[model samples]
Target: MVFWILISFVALAMAALLGLILLRAHSMAEPPAAYDLRVYRQQLSDVDKDLLRGVINDSDAQRVRTEVSRRILAADAQLQKQSSGSPQPKGMSRLTVVLAAALLIGGTLALYSLLGAPGYGDMGLASRIEASDNYARTRPKQAEAESKVPPQPNPNLEPGYADLVAQLRQTAGERPDDAQGQALLAQHEANLGNFIAAYQAKQNYIRIMSGDLEPQDYGELAELMIMAAGGYVSPEAEELLDDTLRLDPRNGPARYYYGLLQGQLDRPDIAFRVWVDTLRQGPKGAPWINGIEAQIEDMAFRAGIEYSPISPPGAAGAQAPALAGPNAEDLEAAQEMTAEDRQEMIRGMVARLSDRLATEGGSAPEWAQLIGALGVLGEQDRAKAIYAEAKTRFADDTEALAQLESAASMAGLEP
Candidate 1:
């Protein structure tokens, strides 16, 4: 929207400038002074010649010559006054010619600056223009994707989160060592309102970034782990994201995901800075920047923290501590787990959660996951009641409340 707005403004400004130039040029093209007088005198001469040849009456020729003489005298007097004028101001003396040329060139440049070049992508004018055009073309698809975003989790999941847990167990079994697959499983768990499982999977994904993985692959893994951190305020998850960024400072995905996680943590100032830095580094009109900015704005609005219009005044981004934590160590351990063991473990954990939620009802630690599963399973009323109960029951535990709220939001269940 901002990009299109800017383009419209530029187009209007260019049209206005062109109109002004045409108007000025028209004003400068006044009728010539001496030419009109000269033509009148020539006509008078022809009348006199006709009279001498007895072609016209004497009175008519005399009257025409008098008017022609009067016009000639008026033209001469005006010319003499113009020629006799005092010198122009010193600033404009020989500078008139220079100033006129300067005005023409400078006006063109000023107009171009205001309306032609958009300072985007840290690119040259031509490059910026091209990129802006390209972004414009793709923006509609991006907007539609945003608009059509699934309302939280799909509404076919069931309560006690049995279906979600089952889905994750199945997927984990299918792709035990796949970082992306595990990350997707983790995200689905998160969408199912299972923060613990999400946190576990995210930790596992982060832990596996090791000697075998390329820097780029590590960066991608870091991004998913950071993104999954939004499900829980795990100090471990935070540390992992911070560490990933430290290892790959310029990874756009890692930076964006980290920014989002920061926002989730209600660190608007930090999130804003990270997003601003991302915008500075990436190509102009980058979709990531828009997404990050939107997240930051939403976070700031929710937290009632005023986001600085200007980014944080610093060269450095979010700072991380030197030491790794237990979760990080656990991730490292998970990386060493045999694929079969990992699959069996996740399956057992999901089954345990399902059993606990079914027996213990909404008071269980895994109730939210059940609610999410229930929401997906088309138990809309049950999910809403469960979410409302969780929100009220766990009101004292901000983390629990937040998790419940997140689940409700994803489930599209009113709280």
Candidate 2:
């Protein structure tokens, strides 16, 4: 109310100033002929003075007087004609002033009403941060967010595949201790868009494999939980993300979701930094890279960064990075070798691949293959080291990290 009063006062004052200027100009203005008449009368007075002082002869003074009198008459006649023809419209002038003032005041108020938040008070930076923190602290829980999401439609699926999924779910429910069955159930459930069921299956899998839980397991659970809540990163999902990142600090999915959580908490500054770093360490087709590319500009704006949009790597008809791996001809030749000889050849190939990777960086799949080959050779320490390095190398590529994690598990390392 006070703000409105102040704005109204200022607008009214400006309109009043304009009205005074207009009125003063109208009142002080004189006709051109009136100025001419005044000059002519002054000249006539000078001629009379000249005659009295005997500065001019009687005839000369009389001629000057006549000429001045004729000019005065002509000027007076023009002034009277002008006055009668176009009399100052005092009422119209007042009406114009009134309209102008009304427009000024009314237009100002109307524009403000349209564009300004009428009742919202100004917030300082600290106050805004406090409010955002409060809001984040009180945001909806996992169950509440899940409840608010509308039911998703069943995906179109082949009858054979659907029946298999249903049978898998029933079997997994019956055999609660079957870790492999639960993992399969979770995978299929998530594929069917049943994320709530998927996460529940994943929870069972994690419990059954508690002794062998991996960072990918926690990341998967968090992703399912977020999907269950229609992409809301609830507290439960955040906890899972924390676990994933604690186990593997460079986990791509965990970091991406953490960035998303920051954004939801109204901390775009942190979110922007996290996403920018993640996007920079990209294998072009990573899921998080696309999500970050789509939203990073808006986040940058919110965080007050002057950012220009960037194209994703391998975009615009650019060739994808070539992945180094064994060719089909090598596989065919290995097949013809005896078991002992094949084993020898495999060790030689693995040694060569490892040397090449050490000299020049390779794709995530090639790294995973090397880890798995080391595991096959019973080199546990080397496999573990390779797995760790692979995780760090492809830290921002979620799919690549998943593959690396799978290779790590197969390598018989503790999760």
Candidate 3:
């Protein structure tokens, strides 16, 4: 009863307001603005004063006075008509206003009755959420299908890479004692982003090379493990990364991957700092710089910092020194040229380097450079041949053997 009483009062109040508007509209039928008569008479007086002062010419004053006189006459006529009490018609007819008000109220309520939950009670926030939850529970299959789909394998892997992987697996299986073969398989798998096989091959290689391990070896294993876990650096990988940094604090790949792990763990602050420092220390021509630079921009955005990365410390003159021993200008020029021209230039340079190594006998670093250049150019077969030749040439020198072997291993050359 109280609810019905309140609704009745609201309806009555709205009707009363509408009636008042119609009444006022009726009163404004004549729109009594006869004040315009007084304004026009004042303008006529001003024009006469201007004529007496000779401020405006007599002809101009006469025209202004005539216009003001004409407005005065129109206002006087309107005022006289308003005061005549002849029952002037209103601008809006009374019946039309009544019908319009009725239709507005009725149409609004009718639309609400048609579209709204007229019979249902109000649903608060909690009730709405609970209703959604009930809907989800009612369709278990749909919810399951929509909310959880099995992850798929990487679609971007090269088809030929899988064949290489099969051959690599066969070799590793047939020669379990061939750790070097396993190491090469690991690198090739990693390059192809087949991190699961890469991790397995790296595990085998690490076990065999336990006595001859370096920080780089541990870092490689950590990276493979991280990739196998789909970018999540697991606790096992973290331990490997720690071991890598313990042996060598400035390992670029290890540190970069460590930063990635930090980002994955929701520590953008730590990731940003690590990557910024690593970028500063690394050469601009480093292969990983491009990836790091892209990642660092995202990190900076999430960390809410406007970061402008400076070129690595030693890239002052032309370009950062290439790891493959190309001069700064050559590498910079490669970036500026067309792809075909760049390839031709690179082939020429590689040929020259190869010719020099074959005839004059350059340093171990030079041989490593040629092999690395071959790797970058996707000539892994040629790189493997170069690695074999460099091994024989550096057989008497342990340091030279280590450097050349490291380069060859990076290029995916088997022992």
Candidate 4:
């Protein structure tokens, strides 16, 4: 109520000031004809003074006096015409002032009501930060977030592949001690977009590999968990992100998700800073780069920063790395070879590519190909492991991750 009273008082004061200005202007203004009349009368007086002083001969003075008198009469007539004309009605003038005042106050209040937080008081930086912290501390947990998310539809899969996934799920569930089975189930479930099941399987895999866990392990689990919760950064996922960062401070995926967590917690200032730094430290292809680009402007606005969108370095006219795969000649050669020979040839190619990547890092497409080739050769476990490593490798590269995801899908590893 006090806030309203204060705002109303200020608005009314401004409106009254405008009205006073208008009224004063109208009251003090002199007619153009009145000024002309005064000037002509002064000229006639000067003519008479000149006649008396003999500055001019009597005949010349008389002619000048006659001209000045004619001008005075014309000026007087114009002044009389102006004065006799219908004057601005006092009521109408007052109505105009009232309308202007009403518009000034009403328009300001209406615009504020539409665009401003009516009751929200101005918050200092420290107060805002404290509020954000309190909000973060009170945010929903993983289970609660997951509960609020609507059920996602499973991806369309071929019958044979669907059956295989079903069998894998059953086998992995029955063999709780089998880490390899759990890993496979996790990969396949994720590929089928069963993120909840995928994350659960990942949990089992993490438990089994607890003694040998890497940052990427926790990062992957957090990624799946976030996906399962429809991108909400749950407390569990936040903890996983913390663990990932603790192990590898520069983990791109974990850092990106952590910034997202900050945004969700009403701390866009921190989120903006984190995302800006992350965007600048680019593999330009990082999976989170697009997300950052899409959202960072809004975050900056919320953080009270004057921000222009920054494109990732090398984003303009950037080309994908040339994929390392068989050419037409190799295809033709393979067509002529015996089935066993062809299989052997493919295996030889895969081996050479694998060795090259292991010794000297290759492009993301090459890694994706190797993963897919491994899967085709009945090496699902190796494909799954390679998929994980490839994701970690191109974590910052959105385009590379997209290519890797496509290959992973084809390899029946994960989505």
Q: Scored by CA lDDT, what does every candidate get? A: 0.55, 0.79, 0.71, 0.78
lDDT for each residue of candidate 2 in 1-415, tens digit (9 for 90 to 100): 7787899899999999989987876787788888898798889888889889989999998888888888888888888878633335788778889999999999997898899887888677898789888987888999999999998998964223455567677787899997766776787788799999999988998998886777888998999999999999998899999999999877767888999999898889999988877776664556777788888888888889998766545422122232233466866675566655655655677788888888987777788778866765658899888888878887887667767777666455654
lDDT for each residue of candidate 4 in 360-384, tens digit (9 for 90 to 100): 8877878887886686566888888
lDDT of 3 at 353: 83
Using TM-score, rank the candidates from best to worst.
4, 2, 3, 1
Q: Pairing residues by index, what is the TM-score of model 2?
A: 0.63
Screening candidate 2 with a backbone cut-off below 3 angstroms (N, C-alpha, C), the clashing residue pairs are none
Task: Give the residue spans of candidate 3 off by over 4 A.
Answer: 1-66, 75-181, 191-193, 307-405, 408-415
Tell how far residue 246 is off in model 4, in angstroms. Answer: 1.3
RMSD of each: 20.3, 10.6, 13.4, 7.7
The residue pairs that clash in candidate 4, if any, are 285-396, 285-397, 285-398, 286-396, 286-397, 286-398
Candidate 3 lDDT over residue span 1-415, tens digit each: 4443565576566866887777776665543435577678788888989888989998998899888888878888888767643333564556666776687667656876797556665666667556645653443332233234345366453223344456667877898777766876786677676677788888898898777777889998887776566566666777899999999988888889888867765567778998898888865645456568878989988667898975765331123233333566765665566645655665776788898778977777788878866865558899998998988987986656766877777665654
**Candidate rank order under lDDT:** 2, 4, 3, 1
Error of 4 at 151 (Å): 2.4
- What TM-score would every model get versus the actual structure? 0.28, 0.63, 0.47, 0.73
